[model samples]
Target: MPDTAGLAVRTLTPDAPAEAPPVLLVHGFGSDGAGDWIDTGVAAALTAAGRTVIIPDLRGHGASPAPESAAEATAPALAADLLAAADAAGAATFDIAGYSLGARVAWAVAAAAPDRVERSVLGGLSPVEPFTAVDIEALHRAVREGAQCPDPFTAAIAGMVSAHGDRAPGLALCVEGLRDTPFAGGAWDAKVLPVFVVGENDELTRGIDGLAGSLGARLVTVPGAHHEVLGGPHFRDTVLDVLAR
Candidate 1:
């Protein structure tokens, strides 16, 4: 099939424009469009500040389609979704930002199609967290066996992610993507001067810093846990600084 990147895209169009262009937000793995940022109030915050915003549920995460194979879910494929979504959102060109897994996809998109994007804020990822070969055989076994655990977070520390997915047909697309993309953790083809944000004390922070240093980018520490950083004032201030630059 054609490059799977950018094939899946969703938008949250705004009614007003701020001094700057609209901001597209991409959520991390295991979350959807609304709960990802809309429910978190990030979308509303920027909108209130007069910045038009667009949020997408990156592949294997939300409304976007999950490719049947990891090859289809590669960073290139998911970046394609940003393009399609931006076009659909009526943003001929735009600034973009993403969190965690979403941040990775954003990097992929910016790397693959820099001309289409102006600036980007990548939150919660570091280059040190290199993507490794997956134990797909074991992962598939867990899925087929209907596994459940109260302390899955412990395992997630090693990227052993698990979630109760939707029965809706759309979820299958995302799930398939999760199964396919082993997150071969490294910067792909990208040269954008991205604004990277991470939580202080986050194990992932150093990794993100490493990535930024390699790319001639800068880093911002938001002083919170990984998931909650997006909600705090630091989140907005950091983003505004990036956009202002």
Candidate 2:
């Protein structure tokens, strides 16, 4: 079923035991749940653990509609979309986890419906909002005008958008929509079952301990960089152990 925002979603279940607290997995910017979770073996691991996983391709990515308007990509809007996915899956309560942009959005979800989210794992994210300093214009220039942009990071982001095929323009719009919105520590409710996970070498690691202190969550650091952390055993084990406990 399509969400209120008409985003595409999928629910994968293990064959042996179909009844388990559902786990909703959200992907990072310019990436879908399948690519970020399924292909990475995270989803498979969850399913093997008898978890029913609901994966939504956030708006402007994967099978979801790429809205031309940037406003459709706001964190609150994406958060609601995840809730809608839960509703569609008939999940009154579920565990949620996300990485990068997805982690930011998951924080929004926990804030929006503290009662619904049983536990959450925020991975590859930091206390400080990652995209606050990003230059959307420079990203657009690199992809649209083929201009020589100074920031390699921004340029690489633009390249990722372009590699996403037809969603390029929409992804760019989403990036612009997310520009003014940074992850606010206040959005993390202390009552929520939240865990903060990040790569040991990730630049985002700064101030994470402070944020975790505020959220009353344990901060777990694994060995790897921001992107590589997701594919490693430590990160995956940390999440699974949290959920298992």
lDDT of 2: 0.82
Candidate 1 structure quality by residue, lDDT tens digits, 128-177: 43333334444444454544323443224223344544422233334345
* Residue 71 in candidate 1, Cα distance off native in Å: 3.0
Candidate 2 per-residue lDDT over residues 151-193, each given as its tens digit:
8777777888888767788898788777766777775552555
Candidates' lDDT values, in order?
A: 0.64, 0.82
Instruction: Give the TM-score (vs. native) of candidate 1.
Output: 0.78
